[model samples]
Target: MSKIMSAPTLHHFSSLFTLFIVLLHHSNADVGTASRYSPPYLPSGCYGTEATQFPSSNLFAAAGDGIWDNGAACGRQYLVRCISAEQPRTCIPDQSIQIKIVDYAATAVSPASAGGTTMVLSDKAFGTIANMSATLINIELQQV
Candidate 1:
Protein backbone atom coordinates (compact mmCIF):
# COMPACT_ATOMS: atom_id res chain seq x y z
CA MET A 1 0.00 0.00 0.00
CA SER A 2 2.76 2.51 1.00
CA LYS A 3 4.85 1.45 -2.00
CA ILE A 4 1.93 2.12 -4.33
CA MET A 5 1.42 5.62 -2.91
CA SER A 6 5.15 6.43 -3.24
CA ALA A 7 5.16 5.28 -6.86
CA PRO A 8 2.49 7.80 -7.86
CA THR A 9 4.32 10.63 -6.08
CA LEU A 10 7.57 9.76 -7.81
CA HIS A 11 5.85 9.73 -11.21
CA HIS A 12 4.29 13.13 -10.56
CA PHE A 13 7.67 14.57 -9.56
CA SER A 14 9.30 13.19 -12.67
CA SER A 15 6.58 14.67 -14.88
CA LEU A 16 6.98 18.09 -13.29
CA PHE A 17 10.75 18.00 -13.71
CA THR A 18 10.41 17.14 -17.38
CA LEU A 19 7.99 19.98 -17.96
CA PHE A 20 10.27 22.47 -16.23
CA ILE A 21 13.20 21.43 -18.43
CA VAL A 22 11.14 21.79 -21.60
CA LEU A 23 9.95 25.25 -20.65
CA LEU A 24 13.47 26.35 -19.80
CA HIS A 25 14.83 25.20 -23.12
CA HIS A 26 12.04 26.88 -25.07
CA SER A 27 12.53 30.21 -23.30
CA ASN A 28 16.30 30.27 -23.93
CA ALA A 29 16.10 29.38 -27.64
CA ASP A 30 16.27 33.04 -28.65
CA VAL A 31 18.28 34.36 -25.74
CA GLY A 32 21.27 36.04 -27.38
CA THR A 33 19.14 37.46 -30.21
CA ALA A 34 17.97 40.37 -28.11
CA SER A 35 21.53 41.68 -28.05
CA ARG A 36 21.64 41.83 -31.84
CA TYR A 37 21.04 45.14 -33.55
CA SER A 38 18.40 45.95 -36.12
CA PRO A 39 19.82 48.27 -38.77
CA PRO A 40 18.25 51.41 -40.24
CA TYR A 41 17.71 52.54 -43.84
CA LEU A 42 18.27 55.80 -45.66
CA PRO A 43 16.70 56.71 -48.99
CA SER A 44 19.78 58.45 -50.26
CA GLY A 45 23.03 57.91 -48.41
CA CYS A 46 25.97 60.23 -47.87
CA TYR A 47 28.05 58.12 -50.22
CA GLY A 48 26.67 59.77 -53.34
CA THR A 49 25.58 63.36 -53.63
CA GLU A 50 23.06 65.09 -55.92
CA ALA A 51 25.69 65.67 -58.59
CA THR A 52 26.81 62.03 -58.32
CA GLN A 53 23.58 60.09 -58.41
CA PHE A 54 23.00 56.55 -57.12
CA PRO A 55 20.25 54.21 -58.20
CA SER A 56 17.84 53.00 -55.57
CA SER A 57 17.83 49.54 -57.08
CA ASN A 58 21.47 49.24 -56.15
CA LEU A 59 21.29 47.81 -52.67
CA PHE A 60 24.02 49.34 -50.52
CA ALA A 61 24.99 49.58 -46.90
CA ALA A 62 26.96 51.87 -44.57
CA ALA A 63 29.11 49.69 -42.33
CA GLY A 64 29.13 50.70 -38.71
CA ASP A 65 32.50 51.42 -37.10
CA GLY A 66 32.30 48.33 -34.95
CA ILE A 67 32.12 46.00 -37.97
CA TRP A 68 34.83 47.59 -40.12
CA ASP A 69 37.72 49.77 -39.15
CA ASN A 70 39.14 52.75 -41.06
CA GLY A 71 37.35 52.32 -44.37
CA ALA A 72 38.10 48.63 -44.88
CA ALA A 73 34.43 47.98 -45.69
CA CYS A 74 34.39 49.83 -49.00
CA GLY A 75 33.76 47.63 -52.02
CA ARG A 76 32.74 44.71 -49.80
CA GLN A 77 29.37 43.09 -50.41
CA TYR A 78 27.28 41.15 -47.97
CA LEU A 79 24.37 38.75 -48.04
CA VAL A 80 21.81 40.36 -45.82
CA ARG A 81 18.52 38.93 -44.62
CA CYS A 82 15.64 40.55 -42.90
CA ILE A 83 14.88 38.27 -39.99
CA SER A 84 12.20 40.49 -38.45
CA ALA A 85 10.61 43.88 -38.84
CA GLU A 86 9.39 46.36 -36.32
CA GLN A 87 5.81 46.23 -37.49
CA PRO A 88 4.76 42.60 -37.40
CA ARG A 89 2.05 43.23 -39.96
CA THR A 90 4.58 44.66 -42.40
CA CYS A 91 7.18 41.94 -41.99
CA ILE A 92 7.88 39.67 -44.95
CA PRO A 93 9.58 36.60 -43.57
CA ASP A 94 12.99 35.23 -44.58
CA GLN A 95 13.82 37.52 -47.48
CA SER A 96 17.52 37.85 -48.26
CA ILE A 97 19.13 40.74 -50.14
CA GLN A 98 22.73 41.30 -51.17
CA ILE A 99 24.27 44.73 -50.71
CA LYS A 100 27.59 46.45 -51.22
CA ILE A 101 29.27 48.52 -48.55
CA VAL A 102 29.34 51.97 -50.05
CA ASP A 103 29.81 54.07 -46.97
CA TYR A 104 30.77 54.03 -43.31
CA ALA A 105 29.08 54.97 -40.06
CA ALA A 106 30.66 57.07 -37.35
CA THR A 107 31.69 55.48 -34.07
CA ALA A 108 28.81 57.37 -32.51
CA VAL A 109 26.53 55.18 -34.55
CA SER A 110 27.29 52.44 -32.06
CA PRO A 111 24.57 52.19 -29.45
CA ALA A 112 22.58 54.29 -31.92
CA SER A 113 19.54 53.23 -29.99
CA ALA A 114 18.73 51.18 -26.93
CA GLY A 115 17.83 48.34 -29.27
CA GLY A 116 21.26 48.58 -31.04
CA THR A 117 22.15 49.27 -34.69
CA THR A 118 24.66 47.31 -36.74
CA MET A 119 24.57 49.10 -40.08
CA VAL A 120 22.75 51.59 -42.25
CA LEU A 121 21.19 50.29 -45.45
CA SER A 122 19.87 51.80 -48.63
CA ASP A 123 16.12 52.19 -48.96
CA LYS A 124 15.75 49.67 -51.76
CA ALA A 125 17.64 46.96 -49.90
CA PHE A 126 15.73 47.53 -46.68
CA GLY A 127 12.35 47.59 -48.36
CA THR A 128 13.06 44.54 -50.49
CA ILE A 129 14.03 42.44 -47.50
CA ALA A 130 11.84 43.90 -44.78
CA ASN A 131 8.80 44.65 -46.96
CA MET A 132 7.99 47.25 -44.36
CA SER A 133 8.08 51.01 -44.06
CA ALA A 134 9.88 50.74 -40.75
CA THR A 135 13.09 52.77 -40.48
CA LEU A 136 14.85 49.86 -38.79
CA ILE A 137 14.58 46.08 -38.91
CA ASN A 138 16.48 43.11 -37.51
CA ILE A 139 18.81 41.52 -40.02
CA GLU A 140 21.27 38.69 -40.48
CA LEU A 141 24.34 39.73 -42.44
CA GLN A 142 27.14 37.63 -43.92
CA GLN A 143 30.10 38.64 -46.01
CA VAL A 144 29.92 37.75 -49.65
Candidate 2:
Protein backbone atom coordinates (compact mmCIF):
# COMPACT_ATOMS: atom_id res chain seq x y z
CA MET A 1 0.00 0.00 0.00
CA SER A 2 2.84 2.43 0.83
CA LYS A 3 4.57 1.68 -2.48
CA ILE A 4 1.41 2.52 -4.42
CA MET A 5 1.09 5.88 -2.66
CA SER A 6 4.74 6.78 -3.43
CA ALA A 7 4.30 6.18 -7.15
CA PRO A 8 1.98 9.17 -7.61
CA THR A 9 4.25 11.42 -5.57
CA LEU A 10 7.24 10.41 -7.64
CA HIS A 11 5.39 11.06 -10.86
CA HIS A 12 4.44 14.55 -9.66
CA PHE A 13 8.04 15.24 -8.71
CA SER A 14 9.29 14.26 -12.14
CA SER A 15 6.77 16.55 -13.83
CA LEU A 16 7.84 19.48 -11.68
CA PHE A 17 11.47 18.78 -12.40
CA THR A 18 10.88 18.81 -16.14
CA LEU A 19 9.10 22.13 -15.92
CA PHE A 20 11.98 23.63 -13.97
CA ILE A 21 14.52 22.52 -16.57
CA VAL A 22 12.54 24.03 -19.44
CA LEU A 23 12.18 27.36 -17.66
CA LEU A 24 15.86 27.45 -16.86
CA HIS A 25 16.87 26.83 -20.48
CA HIS A 26 14.64 29.61 -21.79
CA SER A 27 15.92 32.10 -19.22
CA ASN A 28 19.48 31.69 -20.40
CA ALA A 29 19.21 32.84 -24.03
CA ASP A 30 17.67 32.80 -27.49
CA VAL A 31 19.64 32.04 -30.67
CA GLY A 32 19.68 34.33 -33.69
CA THR A 33 21.86 35.61 -36.54
CA ALA A 34 23.68 38.94 -36.62
CA SER A 35 25.51 40.90 -39.28
CA ARG A 36 27.67 44.00 -39.05
CA TYR A 37 27.04 47.55 -40.25
CA SER A 38 29.52 50.38 -40.81
CA PRO A 39 29.49 54.08 -39.95
CA PRO A 40 26.91 56.73 -40.97
CA TYR A 41 24.68 55.34 -38.28
CA LEU A 42 22.62 58.45 -38.31
CA PRO A 43 19.25 58.95 -40.04
CA SER A 44 17.95 55.75 -38.52
CA GLY A 45 14.50 54.43 -39.08
CA CYS A 46 13.63 54.99 -35.45
CA TYR A 47 15.44 58.16 -34.46
CA GLY A 48 15.90 59.78 -37.91
CA THR A 49 18.96 61.96 -37.17
CA GLU A 50 18.20 62.79 -33.59
CA ALA A 51 21.04 64.50 -31.73
CA THR A 52 21.38 61.82 -29.09
CA GLN A 53 20.58 58.82 -31.31
CA PHE A 54 23.81 56.92 -31.01
CA PRO A 55 25.02 55.52 -27.72
CA SER A 56 28.27 56.88 -26.34
CA SER A 57 29.79 53.38 -26.43
CA ASN A 58 28.60 52.82 -30.05
CA LEU A 59 27.25 49.46 -29.00
CA PHE A 60 24.11 49.51 -31.02
CA ALA A 61 22.18 47.53 -33.64
CA ALA A 62 19.50 47.75 -36.27
CA ALA A 63 16.64 45.34 -35.85
CA GLY A 64 15.71 42.92 -38.64
CA ASP A 65 12.14 42.09 -39.51
CA GLY A 66 11.87 39.41 -36.87
CA ILE A 67 12.81 41.86 -34.13
CA TRP A 68 11.61 45.12 -35.65
CA ASP A 69 8.09 44.52 -34.28
CA ASN A 70 6.75 47.46 -36.25
CA GLY A 71 8.89 50.11 -34.53
CA ALA A 72 8.01 48.80 -31.08
CA ALA A 73 11.53 47.42 -30.72
CA CYS A 74 13.11 50.86 -30.98
CA GLY A 75 15.29 51.70 -27.95
CA ARG A 76 14.90 48.16 -26.62
CA GLN A 77 18.11 46.84 -25.15
CA TYR A 78 19.54 43.36 -25.64
CA LEU A 79 22.51 41.46 -24.24
CA VAL A 80 24.24 39.71 -27.14
CA ARG A 81 27.11 37.29 -27.63
CA CYS A 82 28.55 35.52 -30.63
CA ILE A 83 27.89 31.78 -30.60
CA SER A 84 29.05 30.59 -34.00
CA ALA A 85 29.70 31.60 -37.60
CA GLU A 86 30.37 30.25 -41.07
CA GLN A 87 34.02 31.22 -40.86
CA PRO A 88 36.17 29.15 -38.54
CA ARG A 89 37.16 30.86 -35.27
CA THR A 90 34.68 33.60 -36.01
CA CYS A 91 33.47 33.93 -32.48
CA ILE A 92 35.46 35.51 -29.70
CA PRO A 93 34.60 33.40 -26.69
CA ASP A 94 33.80 34.76 -23.26
CA GLN A 95 32.72 38.08 -24.66
CA SER A 96 29.33 39.70 -24.80
CA ILE A 97 27.99 43.22 -25.29
CA GLN A 98 24.82 45.03 -24.46
CA ILE A 99 23.35 46.80 -27.51
CA LYS A 100 20.58 49.27 -28.05
CA ILE A 101 18.24 49.07 -31.04
CA VAL A 102 18.52 52.37 -32.86
CA ASP A 103 17.29 51.58 -36.37
CA TYR A 104 15.69 49.12 -38.76
CA ALA A 105 17.98 47.07 -40.99
CA ALA A 106 15.69 47.29 -43.98
CA THR A 107 16.12 51.04 -44.23
CA ALA A 108 19.76 51.32 -43.20
CA VAL A 109 22.29 52.16 -45.91
CA SER A 110 25.59 50.59 -47.00
CA PRO A 111 24.38 47.00 -47.08
CA ALA A 112 23.15 47.19 -43.53
CA SER A 113 23.31 43.44 -42.97
CA ALA A 114 22.99 40.04 -44.56
CA GLY A 115 19.55 39.20 -45.76
CA GLY A 116 17.40 37.43 -43.15
CA THR A 117 19.72 38.24 -40.27
CA THR A 118 18.09 38.89 -36.93
CA MET A 119 19.95 42.12 -36.29
CA VAL A 120 22.61 44.37 -37.79
CA LEU A 121 25.15 45.16 -35.10
CA SER A 122 27.29 48.25 -35.24
CA ASP A 123 30.91 47.74 -36.32
CA LYS A 124 32.12 48.28 -32.76
CA ALA A 125 29.60 45.91 -31.27
CA PHE A 126 30.35 43.21 -33.86
CA GLY A 127 34.09 43.41 -33.31
CA THR A 128 33.62 42.95 -29.58
CA ILE A 129 32.09 39.48 -29.97
CA ALA A 130 33.08 38.21 -33.41
CA ASN A 131 35.69 38.48 -36.13
CA MET A 132 35.08 41.52 -38.29
CA SER A 133 35.72 39.46 -41.40
CA ALA A 134 32.61 37.43 -40.73
CA THR A 135 29.61 38.83 -42.51
CA LEU A 136 27.17 36.99 -40.29
CA ILE A 137 27.33 34.94 -37.13
CA ASN A 138 25.10 33.04 -34.79
CA ILE A 139 24.31 34.88 -31.58
CA GLU A 140 22.77 34.34 -28.21
CA LEU A 141 20.50 37.14 -27.07
CA GLN A 142 18.65 38.00 -23.89
CA GLN A 143 16.51 41.07 -23.49
CA VAL A 144 17.36 43.16 -20.46
Candidate number of the best TM-score: 2
* Per-residue error (Å), model 1, residue 48: 7.1
Pairs that collide in candidate 2 are none
Question: Best candidate, lDDT-wise?
Answer: 2
Q: Estimate candidate 2's alpha-carbon lDDT, on a 0 to 1 scale.
A: 0.91
Q: Which ten residues in a row have the lowest lDDT in candidate 2?
A: 1-10
lDDT by candidate, in order shown = 0.55, 0.91
Model 1 lDDT tens row, 1-144 = 354548889999999999999888732111111122133333223444342333455676666655555767766777777676556855467677677766555432323222335666655666676653476666677777
Write down the TM-score for model 1: 0.54
